[model samples]
Target: MADWDDGYWWSADGLRLHYRDYPGEGLPILCIPGLTRNARDFADVADRLKGRHRLILIELRGRGESAYAKDPMSYVPLTYLQDVQLLIDELKLDRFIMFGTSLGGMITALLATSNAGRLAGALINDVGPVIDPAGMARIRSYVGKSISYPTWLHAARGIAETQTSNFPDFGLHDWLAMAKRLCRLTPAGRIVYDYDMAIAEPFRVPGGGEPGVDMWPVLNALKDIPTLLVRGGLSDLLKPDTAKRMLETLPQMEEVVIGRVGHTPTLSEPPCIAGIDRLLARIAAAG
Candidate 1:
């Protein structure tokens, strides 16, 4: 039995993109994964709510099965926003709820500004207007790093070693599952990260480390729509103070903090599940 149907879309510049379409009832729910992550990250979350809502999981350009941009600079968030818009238009999605993580959250912020009237609701996972420098450094250190493993077990151990601080409670089985999700087995018998190394170019550009974009205006656009901000309580990317400031600006936003998790929360977590339920309830009530 097929778990999901394969779908494709073309970027404005003509690059082919990919997404996983999980069919169900109610309004569609679009899930956009974090930087370097693929549609697979949301598999658990989608399975949990299956049959209640149609879910579309996107694989951004340069990641997953999507074509890599000819110009690496096109990997920026604005470019990503445009790509998502094109996907929306191609799918003829008049309205849909969005679930975003990390870079995906940034995309959601901008989409809210341009597509505010069309959004049923939004779930931003562990990202905000101001990204923490410490978190940035940590991410930069690993992205595009030289990585090769002889065995799945070795790959899983590497992931556990590097990410244990982020998910302190993850056991051996959890790390192994995450490894299988993140690292793909090549026909040559080597294990490697699934995304293109060129995808890291945007991060190495001059001034890339700085939060050059003014996200306040974009976030302010979220006003009037029901929004949910899910943060990993120990998250370094989205500081408590910044989330506080965000709430101050968008008082209508519902917030949840998943303890011990860092950078981002796996929506499978109890708190995240509860938060999503509340957000969807609000969305359903809006109709």
Candidate 2:
């Protein structure tokens, strides 16, 4: 197992946020997970890269050990960007590689536009400037629901049942592993989603789903930065055309698509691992 310390920092609003800091030499890799996900989502990556390069796996507010926001409206991407910025300042990180997935990828895009100089490299996993409506509807359908299962097995089975199409190759063991990452064992002995349910309130409002703004300009800001784009072959979120446009916008960007998965890749897939290694090497050589 990779050695890591539980790190904490306060948000501007005084909420205590958490992260997993795996210490090492050289430039650190700052990981930002998907919405409703937490630091554990990057455990595999941490284990692989531990002692080679530092890894900071962030738990965005309301997820993992982070303090939940009293105001649900604060769950927006810009708010998330602010929270991440505070952490960067707290760590005094002058430059770092960003590995962002899903909602985190959106935040990374915003960062690229706002402060491109701070990024050493970027790995955008399974997301693009334009989100597909089908994926948005699918995510909205289950994001806020309060559901629990009696045991880990039951929780894994529940996820397996509902997400069979998304992860066609997932076996019972795979589902159980995913469940361990996405759900928590409560004091009452039930297993439940790890995030604050209130995080979904913004989605309920009209025109509140994925941001309506054009994000191409935000993504284009990465043109001069070293970047790697990872996609899942069955992904509904990042369609083929959108991925093509992203490459067009940043023609030098490297890409890899994991087969038989949708919406996101766990970053542990062999192809993704290789692509990330290549990206990291390029960043190092540039320095």
Candidate 3:
């Protein structure tokens, strides 16, 4: 097993972005976390892919150990694209693959449109050009909310229960790992996750009032780039219909659906991982 190495890269605005690298000699794969998530979210998948690819998991600004932006509005997608660019430059990677979940998927879409030359391929997990408003509202409810738990185990239990529908087969260890990633022990021994609550302000303020921006043009812009879209079978966020639309528009793209999951399917699951492996194989064959 490869040991995870931790580090940080300073963004152009001076916010320190945290990341973890699992070293390998093959292609570099950059994994971007969802909104309010961090590098640790990819721990399981990264561990599995360690021998085949150099896994780089980034803790987007305002999440994980990354420094929060003073201007909360900067938390938008454009800022995140710049952050990815800086991280690539700092690591001296000329080209790379992106594996993004949810909000991270949006970032990947933006980059695919804006910097296609720097990208080799992209894996978008449970996100598309059109976002579900109900899903957005559900996410807003928890993004910056504070939760108090008496113990790490208690927090883990809470997470497991709330996420039971999505991960019915996950064991205690999975919960424990999730709790550790989502929360940190304070000097007083209190556990808290690393994130600025204000990071949720913009979305909450926007409320589901608008469809936000139309991303079809952005999606169409990346038609030539090799792409894969993974959707959780039970996901309310990325509807199956939209996935079909994506496949129709991007004829060369690959798509997969993980059974019994919702919102997003962590690529760690066997089915999802197999799909990703196939995508990588195609990329290798092309090269």
Most TM-score-accurate candidate: 2
- What are the per-residue Cα lDDT tens digits for candidate 1 across 1-287? 76799999999998999999998897888899988899898999888877898899999998888998899878788888889999898888888889999998888888887886788889999999998989998988998776989998999899999999999999988988888778788899999988888777888987563335799888988878889999998898999999999999997798999998997788888888888999989888888
Q: What is the C-alpha local distance difference test score of candidate 3?
A: 0.81
TM-score for each model: 0.97, 0.97, 0.92
Q: Which of the two candidates, 2 or 3, achieves a greater TM-score against the reference?
A: 2
Range of the 10 consecutive residues with the lowest summed lDDT in candidate 3:
204-213
**Residues 167-270, model 3: lDDT tens digits:** 77778998887788777787787777667777776775643322256888888765876788999888878988889999999976998888888877878777
- RMSD (Å) per prediction: 1.3, 1.2, 2.2
lDDT of each: 0.88, 0.90, 0.81
lDDT of 2 by residue, 1-287 (tens): 64999999999999999999999886899999999899989999998998889999999999999999999999888899899988988898888889999999988887767666788889999999888989989889999899999999999999998789889999999999999999999999999999999999999888675655688878888898789999999998999999998998996698899999887899999999999899989998888
The worst-scoring run of ten residues by lDDT in candidate 2 lies at 205-214
- Which candidate number maximizes lDDT? 2
Model 1 misplacement above 4 A: 209-212
